[model samples]
Target chain A: MPVLYASLLTLFLILIPGIGIGLFNMKALFGIVVLYGAFLIFISGVIYRVIIWAKSPVPFSIPTVCGQAKSLPWIRQNKIESPHTSWGVIKRMLLEVLFFRSLLRNEKGRLKTGGRLLFYRNLLLWFGGVLFHWSLFIIIIRHLRLFLEPVPSFVEFIYGLDGLFELFTPPLLITDLLILLGIIYLFFRRLFDPQTRYISISTDYFPLMLIFAIVITGLLIRHVQKVDIMGIKAFLIGLFSFNPSLPKESNTIFYIHLFLVATLLSYLPFSKLIHMAGVFFSPTRNLKNSSRMERHINPWDYPVLVHTYEEWEDEFRAAMKDVGLPVEKEN
Target chain B: MVYDKGKVITGLVVFLIILLSPLWYNALSGKVEPSLKLSMPKEEKSCIEERMFMRSNHMDLLIKWRDDAVRKGIRTYKGLDGKVYRISLTGTCLSCHIDKAGFCDRCHGYSGVKTPKCWDCHNIPKEEGSKV
Candidate 1:
């Protein structure tokens, strides 16, 4: 089914550019048009999505509380989980963005043989998520060396730290291995977990397969394909500066890597991959749990015309008096 | 069940427009084609490496040369054609590619690539007058 279709679609995406640039020599198309197009789409689409999310009104203070809220002076409050102020919310967001604190607390439940419930910390998901994100960040930072002309000191420092082991000729980067392992763990988790498998759709599997293909192509370029690094830097620098160029004898693997990256960038806005940007605008994560202290009036709420009890009484007074009923005002 | 179809459709339309903005811009502006230029040396018949290899890998070769000359004190580079070249920017490369502006900046300027480090230690030839 869906998984098969997703896998095939992902394979086709990888192959189209892989073959186009590698075999048909459509390097110029992939290098210039695809790269620039993807970048523009990525930037504009993200901004559009973020703006749309921002425009949507949050009518209530719905911050998810995982720990004790601010109550009595003597009672301790969990500022990170159940924030009461803007500063507390900032801290909570920092923890959520950096460490995925909420995900870290995820638990799995099972029914025991004696009909008792059992709960266990699901550390594997958290570990894989953290590893994937951090490694991806490090890899992106390391790639700055190619885009930048002078090769910034921070990028060099990260690159040095990543290749400190010096295991092989080109020196194996730890993040490379970590990202691959992380993606593998995540993919397998989705497949093995019955609950996850039941809920998973083609979209879920497509990104995983796409990312796997991207990472594999990248690895192949670094180790197996033997691409000209200087050429890549030149091409990238040129690209960023608006004067684009492709090396005459560019490696096919490089084109594959670039195409996959382009595909990911373009697909980001439409797909669930936009959770990266959506997380910040999420009402549950961004809002402070301060409904107890401060009243939240919905900005969209309108003043309504209503018949008050006093008005009702006045209107009915004449009719009541006519019928000889007791009225409050005996004018 | 009570869904704002109009709002949802508007959002979808906006999303689609944003996603297709690049393609639209490209079609309208006619800036899709990319032009690349590399400077050709006047006197030198062959570089230390092949023309195609040099075009793509000149920066790497230069970096390796810089490290070897500055750190290891090895100034000679054995070419693929069994020729030993004395690896110095001013003494070797600039000798035949006399005008930095005409030879180097032509391609670098077209590519919008800035290499400030090359001139940090070595003085730019006064004849060219620092176009970069």
Candidate 2:
């Protein structure tokens, strides 16, 4: 089932761009409309999934506790892991969201002396994960130049900072390289690691592969194919303005890049990637662990007629007497 | 114990508020700018005057084309000397025109093209005497 789901997702992800490119390359109005319709479906699906997950039954308080649970006053607690207070939870959530701290804590199994197996703290996965995510975020922010009017100064600053490590011709974007490298490392490790591969379904590999394809296609368009950036911007602006005019000389490579982006957008909500939104709605991350501190009566529980212990005992006294059962009043 | 209607009501109300407040704000804050009158060059003035006749979409298109010219780094924007102008046709027009039909399906709206992703960079209804 996991393999099927992942395969279907990967197929959709890959085909969406293929279809978008086919349509966009044709420059047909119907094609563009279809693209928009596809986008609508994608957006709707994402929201639906999020809402359903948000409404899912979290019947128990099963937070992955790693900290001291606000117990004895003198006990020292791991504030950042097993958070007991709202502030602590927030701190924990920040680390989880920004750093993937839990994943960072993952230990790699190592074979030691005399064939004794041991687990050692692995920082590479954590570093790769963080590098990929932050770099991807920076790249996205930098690209906001193409989308926003007056392009926020922060975006420009980031763009400049990203270009700081450029040592080659045309000024290489370091974040781009980092993200590419990170994706590559992650992909190979997933494939090469024996334990990971043993448990890994095709679904796990699909997203990584899809991302790799996207990065490659993007790089090709930027560096090799050399699509006219201005023309592309014009196209985007034109798309944003409700006037879709193609320049007489349009580059096919630009269409490929756009197709991939559009595909990613439409696919985002349906896939594991929707975790972006899921992270916010997560009861674990968002909800305060105030169960012990404050009463959390189930909001869904219905009101019912109360029967006190005394009343119950009185009702059951005759039956208890017949059964020779002891009671407060020995009938 | 069964369901609590009061709690459900509270949750629903909170959910509605969270979802609708931003949408309400978005709708309330949107202000469509007034369309501009086209100030044409002397040779093309009469021709454009007959065509536009106070219609703003035409002016909007003209401004779009001019901005497109500037964005292409075209030297066509007058009074800039010894500057490199990269004159080119671009997809800016298509971005907004393509999205118009679905976006403006109401009010008997009619546009020659469909795009909605354009207004990000250039000002719509381009102002007269503004630098390209």
Candidate 3:
């Protein structure tokens, strides 16, 4: 099902740009408005989906356990994974979200000499995944510099930091290259690993392909395609001011890039990519393990009337007598 | 064994069909131009041929400073018209790169910067070819 959805989604993403470009170029105001309206729906839908998930009820405490549960005072406990209190949960969530501590700690076990099991940290996978996510995040934040009028001080700061190692002649972006490499490794792993390959569907391939498309298109526009930067800035400025005028002297790759990006935006909520927001509302990550200390009554449970044991015995007196069984009360 | 073989053959054919269709389409479509037109009026485009053109950059910086002045309206600049233009400088890059996704990508794609979904907020102009 995910494969089918992803395939259709990929096709939609690929097609929308062409259609939107066609509509936009033709000065079809209705088409542009409708397409943009659809875009707005997807963006808002993502937010709504996230909020609904945030407000939804969890019937169980199913946090993935890596450390000890918060229990007896005499025994040491791992507060991060199986947190008992809000603070502990927050700490655990921070580590999980910020550093991917759980993913970092993941290990693959293999049989060793003398039939002993050997657990080895999957550092390469962990590092690759971590690098991909962190760099992706930094890239996202850094790219925000392009949207704002007066680039935020923090954005400039990050840009400065990223460009700190000007090792390459033109100065290479470590995070950018790191993110691209990391995603490539992940894609390769999924394609090559038997386990990942078995479970993988077209959706898995779609994001990778789309993201690679976005990245390559962007790189080409910047370093190779050599677009009219000034004109682009003019158009960006106009858009920020809510007066979007087509920039003069723009490149075609830019259109391709924009089209791919719009597709990603329109598809985010429906895809597993929602995990970015899902982390915050995840019951396992956010919910406290208070079941041991306090009884959690499911809000959905309702009161029901049933016969008491005494009443049941009275009602079934004739049957009980025939069976020669004891009753709750002598009826 | 026959059934398994049939399924395998079916999957291969599907994969080949999926891969070939795009190749066929591209072959038939010729070179797909950007959705937007590239040519501008000669006066506007004269800068394209100039290697050491500073007017665009100068204008960019001037407009940027002008924007800052306007936002930080307390400051004032003497414009070519001789009237004082507001010189507000509360800097925020989002001020200009509003539709980073839409507008910047037009050029950045050529420049090779990874484009993001920055357009959800800022609207991109319809490409000339695809313009409305």
The lDDT for every candidate, in the order shown, is 0.77, 0.58, 0.60
TM-score each candidate.
Answer: 0.74, 0.65, 0.64
Candidate 2, superposed: residue stretches over 4 Å from native: A1-25, A29-31, A111-115, A166-169, A247-249, A303-312, A316-326, B1-132
In the range B10-84, model 3's lDDT, one tens digit per residue, is 534563454233234334544322233333323332322142232223233444465565566545555544656
Q: Which structure among the candidates has the greatest TM-score?
A: 1
Interface C-alpha RMSD after superposing true interface residues, each candidate, one decimal:
9.4, 13.2, 17.5
In the range A1-331, model 2's lDDT, one tens digit per residue, is 4446655775665555456555555654323554566566665776577557656656555566756676678998667766777778778878888889888778878899999999999898988898889988887777755543334567667876776754432246788889988988887787788787788777577777667667776676555555444344445444445565653324454554555566666777777788876775566675555568776655456889999988988999999988988888764
Tens-place lDDT digits, model 1, residues A1-331:
6689889998898789878976799878998999899988887788678667767877888988888999999999987789899899889888888998888888999999999999999888989999999999899877766655455567777887898786643567899999989999998888899999999988988998898898888888776655656566656756765677765546887888888999999999889999987887788987789899999878678999999867887989889888988877665
Model 1 TM: 0.74
Pairs with steric clashes in candidate 1: none
Residue B37 accuracy (lDDT) in model 3 = 39
Please tell me how candidate 2 rates in CAPRI terms. Answer: incorrect
Kept native contacts, as fractions per model, are 0.01, 0.00, 0.00
DockQ of each: 0.06, 0.03, 0.02
By summed lDDT, which 10 consecutive residues of candidate 3 chain A come out lowest? A26-35
Candidate 2: what lDDT? 0.58
